[model samples]
Target: MRSVDADLIRQPASVLAAAISEGEVSSLEVTKAHLARITEVDERVHAFLQVTGEAALAAAELVDEKRRAGAKLGALAGVPIAVKDVLTMRGVPTTCGSKILEGWRPPYDSTVVARLRAADMVILGKTNMDEFAMGSSTEHSAYGPTHNPWDLTRIPGGSGGGSAASLAAFEAPLAIGTDTGGSIRQPAAVTGTVGVKPTYGGVSRYGLVALASSLDQAGPCARSVLDAALLHSVIAGHDPRDSTSINAPVPDVVGAANRGDVRGLRIGLVKELSGAGYQAGVLQRFNEAVELLQGLGAEVVEVSCPNFDYALGAYYLILPAEASSNLARFDGMRYGLRAGDDGSNSVEQVMSLSREAGFGAEVKRRIMLGTYALSSGYYDAYYGQAQKVRTLITRDFNAAFDKADVLISPTAPTTAFKIGEKVDDPLAMYLNDIATIPVNLAGNCAMSLPVGLAPADGLPVGLQIMAPPMADDRLYLVGSALESALTDKWGHLLIEEVPSL
Candidate 1:
């Protein structure tokens, strides 16, 4: 067997699956190659919190046995996928990159994890993430930061930074990540990978550690839209275990990917996102992407979702308020790490001490803010008002959909920044997701693909494509079309064009 390099890992999962099925390569060989690649590159990138080597190879051996037995296999049989720590996998420690839950393993698997296993996908391991998925940069992770593969000193965007960095570093071809406010898409944008946040409730969240219950969603990260669609199809559908999981039938996203042209497709460009707040280089790349869409026969139009101006504020309020309530379950007695070993202290002292020791600074800050926002005197003023704003944001998206099939924007205001640059200022870091948050609030589907590299810093920029509720197939349709057009124009995938380290 040949060694796997960055270019080889960039091949779509479908191609790898085909090769594995034909006996061109054994599942064990594929798993070992990915593990070697991670060993070579991940130390500098800090992409994974844990690497499940023995278990992954053991699963691969089973896949090989099934192949030899001539049994039917899943579409992604033998493919390796990096799972974000936010999703629970039985017997694997799911830290969610928080010290509070360090070394804690769930008794059961998340719906997405189960689906991946059913598909015969090899679980590479848990990736690093922001503590409780609270920040836009992975610097807040209790385990440490994940660096950008493009430039080791820069960020790879966050919460899903580990997933994005893994793809960029050629550590894995497919990864699963969660998005609350641009966690998946932003990381994909900066790392030059394709990341999709399926329509809210499209994928079940049965064992996912909650960040913001109403807004958090998990989806696929890969090098192409088709791969994302493939992973999305397998994991999306109704799950009886999660009450909020949508009962609607999962669409044939792969079929949508096969629909090549965007001819006569009405693509809306949100005017608000392209304005002053956006970096000049980001806007340039965004405009170029729009031009590519037009050349591909898409009917591009400028649309305004006037309520978007308030989205950032609304999200900050709602996310923290919900996070405070959801994270309250992490008392000293229930799970992983516990502080204050002295038995003389009261129960309340033990709980407080554990939290104070376990949580990082950002987590503490958010908890305090959330507690204040939801407190008696401020509940109506802060949390209640934020809910009203969320309603208005949803209305704005609804009105925009009436005019266009989908909306587009720059996934982030700027390209990947240097690590530690925004770690001190929570507000500044949160602003990075201004454009992507509204979609989550509206329970719509969205995806981000590398549009082009920004000239200012030479880092990749991402173009975000969004669709109305349950219109997830449309995102894949447009995203695949745009990806095909852009890659053809550049003569390579965005990540392929990056300067090799």
Candidate 2:
């Protein structure tokens, strides 16, 4: 076994993979190092819902054995990674941080998880998330919220917060996250990690727990753009099992990430996503990043996505409406927790009671909101109207892309907020995704990379790069370039500045 340091844990997945491939460290050692990290800081970070130590060690041992036998391996082989709870892993507990499915172990692996296994990556564990992937801050999680590693009192962002937190905390080199209304990117933004929401169909949805079917996308979360591209290459491809999976070649994201050149690229700053509503420090860092891009010879321009203002309203309606339909399968009759099953109660009563007891306030709120929007009388007025707005948002992206190679914005209005500060304020909580929701509605590729820390809050601020749908490589190309420039200026990545637990 090779001795490992905090520096080993701090290295990005790409560096870890190279070390393992070069025989400087065995996969088992890497896995043990990460598992040790989970043991060390997870109590404070609460990033994981459960840690699959034995399974991870076994998987790492296999990678080591194969390496010793001189067998060819995937580029990310021997790296340990975390999976957001929304993705099913065979026999692993995947509650989505909701009590409705408490004690449930998935029977089979999701397409993404299967791909990770095939690549010989060690699955460290499942991370915590908002119940049913519903909230902007992870405080909606049934298992209690994952605290920001930067400031323990603050949130780690939502739905995919645990995945982002784990990477920021250095508990895992890479993680998988889902973006339905910015679950991946928003969390990445506040946590100072790199998160990419691949083009809607670029990654398979099969085996991912449905939140809003059309809006849901599984993507990569890592600490660096190149590391994200490495993980992206492993999980992205056509999956016959998923009807929405695009039957096309996965974009050369790894190559694009390596290129890291914005020279002659036209970068657009979205007019609607920046300015007044954004936090002063967040906007300041974002503007500075834009200046950095210009210094790198990228052409900068302002593009208006006028329809973006309505994205949040439309997304709330569409998301809840779809979530209501998707979550209907959790009735007491089949699986998961069942309540009011006493002989006196009817089956319908049992189902109703079970749902009432199982779901949290936030989940129930969305369910009811969705139910109302989808109700016969209101469908056309609410859900139907929201879809029209969705179309407009898509058009906005299309028009913006025509003017610029990529669109940019501050990933969120602000950095991580105190956990309970906005939990009681639903409107405020939802506002956290203001900049990120438009991309989901448009069904395009977008990424959030830490540009710097907000001086006021001393927390991470992310710059979002959105590319035209299916041109996912552009995100990596721009994100890597910005990441390099920022790193050079700061002398270290933003996450490195995190106060020690």
lDDT of 2: 0.93
Overall lDDT per candidate, in order of appearance: 0.90, 0.93
Which pairs clash inside model 2? none
lDDT of 1 at 155: 90
User: Candidate 1, residues 205-308: lDDT per residue as tens digits?
Assistant: 89989989999899999998888888898889999998999998997788999885689999998988887888999999999989989988989988998989
What would the per-residue lDDT of candidate 2 be over residues 130-171, giving only the tens digit for each residue? 999999888999999998998999999988999999998889
* Alpha-carbon TM-score of each model against the true structure: 0.98, 0.99
The positional error of residue 78 in candidate 1, measured at the CA in angstroms, is: 0.6
Q: How close is candidate 2 to the true structure, as a TM-score?
A: 0.99
lDDT of 2 at 398: 88
